[model samples]
Target: MEELMFCYQCEQTIGGKGCTKAGNCGKDAEVAALQDLLVYQLKGIGFLGNEILKQGKNIDKEISKFVQDACFSTLTNVNFDPERFVEYLNKSQKIKENLKTLLGNVPANAPECVNYTIPASKDEMLKDAKKAGIMYDQNLDMNIRSLRETLIYGLKGMAAYAHHAHVLGFYDNDVDNFFYKAFASTIDNKLSVDDLFNLIMEFGKVNLKCMELLDKANTQTYGNPVPTPVLITKKKGPFIIVSGHDLKDLHELLIQTEGKGINIYTHGEMLPAHGYPELKRFKHLIGNYGGAWQNQQNEFDNIPGCILMTTNCLQKPRDSYKDRIFTTSIVGWPDVQHIREIDGKKDFTPIINKALELGGFTEDEPEKTILVGFGHNTVLSLADKILDAVKKGQIRHFFLIGGCDGARPGRNYYTEIAQKAPKDTIILTLACGKYRFNKLDFGSIGEFPRLLDVGQCNDSYSAIKIAQGLADALGCGINDLPLSLILSWYEQKAVCILLTLLSLGIKNIYLGPTLPAFISPDVLQVLIDKFNIKPISTADAELKTILG
Candidate 1:
């Protein structure tokens, strides 16, 4: 039998033993092999890009953008088309060749990764990719392999956020440069485990910077997100459902669909779009339609309008509504209509016309509201009140339950944690993970609501800011405060966030559904010993332990 693809980059990897046949996220062996080949070529690009930077020369701006997009394409559920990977591989080679001409004659025996080449045909590429997987690293130390994989995964997450910010016209030189450095280091066999571990920590610092850049881009482009109650039910009219995390796409869609008699509803991470002042100003930008990305097929089944996917977390559309589903940016599927940007503007008329033809729902559904937009600014505005509540013993503890939501069976722990928390405890959530309990009422503690939605996973920077602010206001270290991080991770983005937390020396984080399969036993022990990170147990049991 032919060797199957090996992918263990996500939380839902098959049996926690790597996906030998196909990925759980609908990626087949061919796509997975292409992704691995893409990463290998990206290492070469990073090497050349970094060398050019060291010589005080500026690489093409498009090189940075290409690096960001290529890394993002390799992320879980982002791109599955082998043809796209072939295109990326060809582009990477051209970029590397251009950089090489600029750098005159160099050492003849330079690193092999710096001069990596793509095969002439797709068949040759696949044959070569069979030997170029994550396990291809010939390092004898398992710990070294673990740290290297961790760095690669973290960089992939950073690339996604950076790409979003880049599209919104935000660029950070340090953040972009670090990507090249991280990618190049992954192929450097001379680096010791300790050296690689320090680089891994640096990946966390840069990821935090990337997330901060995205936060700035998001807030500046679309004004700061404010506290707003979003309607959860449908209105009787033509409507379009926008999913994924790209605010710019949603912003464009809202503008194009306005006054066209079409209502726009957000789904998954896009739910937080309703709180931005610029986005919410459009009257037709109605409300959110579904829970999280995991429920897209069921929620969208036989839906009456068009659906636009803007980023990752997109599942294969069911045939029942596949024709109405449209994808943009790096998202693609076999037969769905993909809308691309012409000049600088994206024509959403296709999605709009589809919505108009479908005629949406026959009658207005009953009103249901869920509060969102409690970002760092909004939360800090209430700092005095929150601090006073804590001083007065009204708000006992703060529980931050956030990260990507998944379809795994054990994910209900998040919902149960929200349900069982004491009335005085504040539960702050972000990303689609909050969907598990965002609709459930937790009542208010003093003047502050017991549950606060802090935008998307990118707004994790907001959560970190809130924690630091609270720590400063109380004259204590963040770890010494009455705050606990209970995160449910599902993909590479979550890996970056976890590294950010660990980099800050934050301890006692509760993570589930299970620890990453990528972390070797020794590496896991190191994390446990240094940070006290623990796997989640039953909600009641974990709550008792945390409260005590």
Candidate 2:
């Protein structure tokens, strides 16, 4: 049989041997091949775009948006439709072709990526994609290949954030230029391993900027997140469930559904929407209904309302609820009704009508509330009290257990850690990983809550700021503080965040549920030796080791 597509970009690849026949995330060979082709064409566009920038010429804003969308579309589980990938690939080729004309002749020594041509048909594209799989670099030096792949994955995460921020009317020329530079560098075979390693670090720095841009966009548009309690139960009424990371979509949905008797509930990463003042003002905006993205297959299986996915971490819909699933932005699944904007407005009437038809729960389900929006500003506001508690032995340590959540069995370790943490310890959590234990009551340590939610994955910026504030206030290095970072990673976003941490010279981080499959043994040793990053063992043992 012909060799199948290979993809191991996420934490869970089949047996760590790469997904040869089908992705563990429900992506088949066809979608995988098309995604690979899309990435290749993106690189071609990046090469041309970068060359234009080097000449001090401004690249078109639309081209930058195209690159960002294409990169985001290739993220795990975001888009499984082959046709969507084909469309992105063709658009990328058109951008590159247009740039070539405007920028004049190319150098004879240019890399093959700069001269690459898009296949004219879907059949031809699939045939060409076979040669573009990530495994094509397998024969290269192991260390060099590892660094290159790391940089590429980091760029993917950065692109996702940049795209989100761009949609919200925020744009940074430095961030956009770095995307082109990083993409162009990936195809340059002449770069030494050390060069690629430096590029990886540089990408980390730019990723920090990207995250900061997103943080500003979110805060300025929605107001600084304040600590708010979000209900985990559904109300009795027509309701719509909004999932993913797009606050803009949630805001719009809340506006359109207001006073229409259709309640709005947050799901997955959208849970934090309740903390923003602009969003919480909507009376019909109810609370969250589900946990992390991985739990959606079961949580959304028979939901009584329409669900709208606005970004990444979306799984293939089951037949039971597929009819009620609506996708927007770069997210796409075959047969699902996709909502798009025309004249700068999105008509959510179909989703709203579906919710009214379902008639929601018979009565309000009584449930516990989870606290969210303990971002840096909110956390630091209580810093003086927290410091007093720590000095008085009321608070012993701070554990930052945050990152992406996945379906692997070991993910239970996060829940176990949260449960097993002593009462004297305060937990700082972020991203979707908090869902594992956020619903539980950890009680309080003096005036400070035991658990603090710091927004989404990008809010790692806030977590870092909080840590630095503590370090500065105490007049000690960050390493000397009584803090432990036990993070769980499953996607490129997590990878970029980890790189940012390491780039800041932070050490002794505990990473789990498993290490990335792309890290070679030698590369892993470099990380282990330099940063003291360790894979998590049993929660009890790990906790003892950390506290001791």
Error of 2 at 373 (Å): 1.0
State the weakest 10-residue window (summed lDDT) of model 1. 104-113
lDDT for each candidate structure: 0.88, 0.87
User: What does the lDDT read for residue 25 in candidate 2?
Assistant: 90
lDDT, residue 228, candidate 1: 98
lDDT of 1 at 374: 94
Q: Write the per-residue lDDT of candidate 1 for residues 1-548, one digit (tens) a residue.
A: 74578999998899986998889998889889989988888887777777777889887778889998999999998887788788988888888788788776544765776777887899888988865797775555888888889999998889889999999999999999998888878778799988988888888888888989999999998888999999999899888988889999998887888789998999888988988999999999899998889888899999999999998888878999998999899887767898987887899888888889999988998899999999999999889889999999999999999898998899999999999999989999998789999999899976788999998887889999999999999999999999989999999999999999888889999999988999999989988999999999999999999897
Model 2 C-alpha lDDT per residue in residues 370-419, reported as the tens digit of each score: 88999888888888888888899898999999999998888889999999
Model 2 clash count equals 0
RMSD after CA superposition, every candidate: 1.3, 1.3
How do the predictions measure up, each by TM-score?
A: 0.98, 0.98
